[model samples]
Structures are given as C-alpha cells and as structure tokens.
Target: MEPVPLAVGLAALLGLSSAVLEVHVGQTSVVSIKGQQAILPLWYTSYSNSRPFVSCLLERRDPTKHLQVLTYIDGKSKVDEKYFKHRVGFLYPMPSPNVSIAINNTQEDDSGQYMCTVNLGDESSTDGRNIGLVNLTVLVPPSSPTCKIQGTPHVGGNVTMSCKSLSGKPSPMYHWRRTGPSFQVFFAPVQDLSKGTLTLTNLTTDMSGTYICNASNSAGYSNCTITLEVTPAFNAAVVAGAVVGALIGLGLILLFALQMFVYRRKKKDVQEEMANEIKEDAVAPKTLSWAKSPGSDVVSKNGTLSSMNTAQDHKLYPSKPPSDTASVTTATGSMVAYKPPYNNPRGGTLTPTPSLSSQSLPLYFPPTVNGIHCHHANVPVHRNAQHRTNGAQPQAPRQEHTLPPGLTSSTLTRMGAVPVMVPAQSQAGSLV
Candidate 1:
C-alpha cells in the first residue's frame, strides 16, 4: 500500500485508546467498576508524545456559563527548563499556579478539568477537554426478580396481579396473565423468563379477560399476554328446570277441568230433551180401539224393546198397565218398565176379568234357537214350576226368523220390537 496520509495515520493511532491515559468524562465512553480514579487514554487527531500540541479548548455541551479551566501537563517536574517551564502568561483563568499534574493528588474538587496547551509560533490548533464523571459501571451477574399482585381482590372472589424486580442492580422484572379466555373454562399463567410464576385461582366470569407477563433483564426486555374463563354451575340450572315443570303440570290440570265441565253440560242437555218428550206424550188424547196381530216383537217409539206377536193363532193378547214391579236394576242405572197397549182379533172385545194372580208375566221370551221364537205369555203354564221341561212353549208354524249378528242376548220378545204394520208405506219418522 502507498504511504498512509499523515492525518489518517494519526487518527488511527488515537483510536487505540488506552485506559491508562486520563479520566474519561464524555457521555458515551465507559470506565471500569473501580473507575473513581480511572485514567483514560487521550487521542489527538494531529498531536502525539513526539509532536507538540498547541492548546486545549474546554466547553460544556451548552457553553452558556463560560467556565475557564486551568492549564497543566503530567511528568514536568524535572530540572530541565527546556522541557517543563513556560515563559508565556498562564491561560485565561488558572485554578492554581503552574504545577505538574503527575505529582498532584486528585480530589473531587480537582476532578473538574485542566488544559495543557503549547504554542508553536507559526501554527495554531486546539483539542477538546473531556472532564466530569458519569460514573460508568462494569457488569457482574444479575439477581432474581420478585413478584406480587396489585390489590387483594376487587370482586368478591376475583383477584388482581403484578410483579417487580428485587435484587438485580439493573432491575430485572416480570408480569403474569392467564391462558385463553374466549375458548376454554380454565386458564394457566405465563411467567416472565427471569421471574417467578403467576397464577389466578377460584376464577369466575369476573376473571375473564386479558393478562400480561413482562420480563426484563440487563440484556433486554420482553412481555406476553394470556386470557382466562370460568364455567357455569349446577345450582343455576336447577331453578330453571323446576319452573318449567310446574308450568306444564298447571296446564294439564286446567285442561282436565275444562273436559269435566263439557261432559256435565252434555248430560244435562240429554235429560232436558227426554223430559220434554214425556210431557208431550202425557197430554196426547186417550183412545179405545182393538186389532189383531201376528206374534211380532214391538219396539217402542221411545227406544224401548218389547215382545213378539203372531197372526195365525188369532190370539187375544193385551198388555197390562204399569205395575208396582216397574222398578228395574240395570247395568247402567235404575230403569222404569212401562206398560204398552194390547190387540185382540175377536170382535174387538176386551178379555173378561179372570181371577189372575197379581203377578204379571213377560210379553215374550227371546227365541230358544237361531230361528225359533216363543210367545212366553200366550201359553198358560199350568205345569208345576218345579216339574217344567226345558221347552217352556209348544212349537207353532215354521216361520223362520234370525237375529242380527252378536245379538243372541238382545233378542227380546219379537212382538215388542214388531212395528204396528197398520200404517203401511208410511215414512219411518211419521209412524213413530
């Protein structure tokens, strides 16, 4: 390489600053932990131990106060006037008369600044004076950080949290928050890298939200965040279920009450209709007429069943009036047995009174078999009630009649069910 420029060479040498030079009071420079009396290397862009320096300039960053520092140099106590003595007057403001800096003891008062300046008559230059301490520090290992919460708890069971640095000279600290609040029912704390764990216990809905964990060391600083949540409990749900069940039961009770009211109303309506029909029939005119009829079962217009009759026998059959035996024990309730009129073919005459017992007989017994009917009252049963055969009546003609399906028990005397064929070709309602 070509010969380095003089200024470049000199600047490079100053850059190799030694801790043995003079105390460093500049803002960005550093000193050792035991640097109270520290001597920092002095760097000159154009001066060295070999080359003579002209003067030093002392000025604060803001030089408003106009401080005037003294002038001095180290190692000038030798008896050679050529090396130590200065013939010129002292610099503008001298804190003390000329004294060699090497032999002088330094104090906090002496710690301010001094300028060592020289004059080479033909050239003039200046160097900055760095003075005043910033108290630099060399680092050792750091201490552990401590932690705590902000308040005891705000809500009844909720808590607040935070943390701090305890032993480190540089103050290492941390913070803490929980896990995810929006998704899960539980949460965990995230501790700072250099601090103790952070935890939240007995969480509730009040506990849901964000949390923070902060970590700081002498090296750097960082932080993180977490969220928390809580689940609903059984006690809350029980009351809700009970209220719903009670409402349903109350509705069922109301429906049952409405049905009972409707049933009773229908029963009263039917009873009123039957009572009105009875009144009309009782006011109808009475008549005395007679006619003959075949044994035919009669069905009353009032929906009652009666006995059977026959035309070939020309029998005089008269139905008795209502007797004291009108009382009936029925499957449903008490019923009344009423008397029906009678018919005779012999000159429309009434049967003479015989000394008949007060006991009245049934008009017709039901058919013994499928097609055979018997007139139970037409034949006089003189046989002893104890010595009677299963055949209660003698057989007549073979006029076959059959009962409706499943009506074997309901086939009463055919005559009572038989219509009075007198009004032939009349409408069914008109005959009734």
Candidate 2:
C-alpha cells in the first residue's frame, strides 16, 4: 500500500472507529511544567468476554523517534525498559479495564504525541487495534514589560506609546493607562490601537501625568509606568495675575471662616450665662409675706396675721349680702353698706379713740360704708359672763353688736373672718 499520512495511517492500522472496540484520548494537547507529572488521558472498550490487551506509545517527529512505553497482556505487564523504565505506567491497571497512563517527572524532551491502543485476542491484531492520541506542552511566565513614548510629549502634540514583554509561552495582552493621584487609573485617549502600541492624538494639558502599561497572560502579568510632562508656553503677566487672584481668594476665605468661628463662640458664651442665671433663680429661697394671697403677685409686710376664735367667747353676726339687700340693715333699724378699705381716703389707717381697757391697746375699724363695718371686732371674754363668783374680779358687761333680722350664722362664717385681738383672761388664747 502507498504510505499514508501519519495520523490517517495510525487510525487505519488500529481500526480506532471499529464497532467491536473503541479508544479515547485528549483531543487537544495537555500542558505541564518540567519536572512535573503529565497525564496522557486514555480509555477503551472491548466487546470480548475476556479482558483485552492494552498499550501506550510516544511519537516525536523532530527527533524521528517512536517508543512503546506501556503494555499489558495475559495478566502481566511487558513494558519497554529502554524508553520508559519506571517513568510510565497504567493509571488504572488490568482486570479493572482502564488504559490511561502517567508520565512521571516530565521534561522538555517529553513533549510529543502520545498514542494508546487496545487489542482483542483472535479478533484483533497488533496492526488492527483501537487507538487514541494526546499532546502536551510546558509553559513559562513572561518577563517585566518595557514601556516607552516615541514622540515629544507636549500640549496639543501627538504621541505614540509602546509596551512589550519577553519570553512567555502563549503571548501576553497589553493595556495602556494613566496613573493619577490616590493611585487611580484611567485609560489613555486612543487614536489607534495595535498589538503592543497605543497612539494618542491632540494631547491636552490635563493629559500630562504618569502613564502605565500592563501585559498579562494565563502564566503571569507585568507592568511599567512613565511620567509624562506637558509644558506649554504662557504669558508672564497672565500667570502673575492668576496667582495674585488665587492668593486674594484664599485670604478672603480664611477671614470669613475666622469671623464665623468668633460669632459661634460668643453665642455659646451667652447661652451659658443665661443658663447660669436660670439656675440661680431656681435655687434661691423665696421671701414669705403674711398678707400675700394665693396666686397674687402683690408684696406685703412679712409678719404673721392674727385670726379670731369664734368658739371661745365672741359671737359673729353677719350682715345681709349684696344680693339680699341694697345695704346692711342692723338690729337698730339702720342700713349700712360695707366696702373695701383700700379705696378709702383715709388710707385704711387706724387712729386710737378712748381707751377700751387698762391695756391701752388701740382698736381700729376697717373702711365702712354707712356705719356697717367691713370687719368684726373680737369681744372680750370678761364681758357677758356671770358676775365674778367667789371673789373673781367683777366681770365686764358684754357689748352687743346685733345682726340683721334675716341673716343666718352660716352666712356669717362663709363671708370670712377678720384678724382680731383677744382678752387676757381667755384660756383659748388668740388665733394666728
């Protein structure tokens, strides 16, 4: 037969697509580092009742070498000691029916095509067996990338940037960026982009800063940065004016901040002073007044006022109320109206008349209207009692102050009592 392509010839000789037996291996190459184990994945199926034989081989085109690495037949291994030694073996041995193998401590020289074959006794020959193939390649990380600018870096100028990394398996991807304050990264303006080059057109003053290039792959990544300074000619007078204006603005801001600070401080101090005044008012003792009415704001003398004890010896007679009669009507058939002493022309002041007793105490009447008194006097206890029995000093006759004919005692009590002095003889004493 005419010689066939290696792949087609191998498939035809091994009958890999036969219905009686099937073999499988990696459709793509397997990658591994030097000094590391690599698996040449394989599997097979045989319709024979008895376990079939299996073998694995390596083919290298560059060195023109073909080597059988693994074999199993009749419950025993017949390995190639010259090529594999202890470096190759079936991952799953016979009786279990697995055919994959492991290549131990692989090297650059081990990179080649791997083949697996399965044979059924009496039905399959060595040249007509099932087959599979796997290929492997090792990889290495790339070196640091070199970044550079190819044109003058100035305002409104065009520039070209390039990035490259050396010695990496597979290749590396390139990315161009600018590094800003706080380590922020931004993409450069792109006019044209290619494998390892970037073109920036119509550069502005804002584009002047640090630029970076990064290259990455499945193996590793590398980066580099370049400082770009764009110097644009400017008028000296314009620059000076801008600097002066900025300085003035800064000074104004500082002055305004100082004024606000002072205002806030003063406001806080004033609040503190007001708080202290309120606290002092709350803690100070209040002055007491005997004449002060409840809920009234009027100021009065501080001494205690006296009260009368009607149960002792005196009899209180209430005059007719304002609604009962136009004026007070007395037992003597006289009508007298009572009014407040505060509005009196006499200023409610009392002047002593003739002495009522040896004590020489003055008796005063509050403002009266038409002979009707606003207050009742305290009757002396010595008066109106039985004459002194068994040598008691002769008792004084009680003076009578009669009330109107229709007035009741209950009405007198509700009208309120006037403060008064009592006689020295009474044991009940004065009320206060």
Q: In TM-score terms, which candidate is top?
A: 2
Candidate 2 RMSD to the correct structure: 20.0
Candidate 2, which segments miss by more than 4 Å at Cα?
A: 1-22, 26-38, 47-55, 60-89, 93-96, 103-112, 119-127, 137-142, 182-194, 217-220, 232-432
Residues 1-432, candidate 2: write the lDDT tens digits.
Answer: 111134344766787653356665544589876567888766655545677777777788855588777788888877788756788787775654466678888766677887777777645544444787788775545569888888866667778888888756667777777776425443434522236677777877777778788777665677888877765635445677899999999999999999999999999999999999999888665443322433112111211211212222223322111121122222232322233221224333221111112232224233344666533443334434575333223223445434445544444323322123343333332211
Q: Local error of candidate 2 at 349, Å? A: 99
User: What tens digits encode model 1's per-residue C-alpha lDDT throughout 333-424?
Assistant: 32322223233343232211111122223333433645666544333223223554555455433332233443342232222222221110
Candidate 1 residue 421 Cα shift, in angstroms, is: 10
Ten-residue segment with the worst summed lDDT in candidate 2? 298-307
Candidate 1: segments with Cα more than 4 A from true spot: 1-303, 307-346, 350-384, 390-432
Q: After superposition, how far is residue 375 of candidate 2 from its true place, in Å?
A: 99
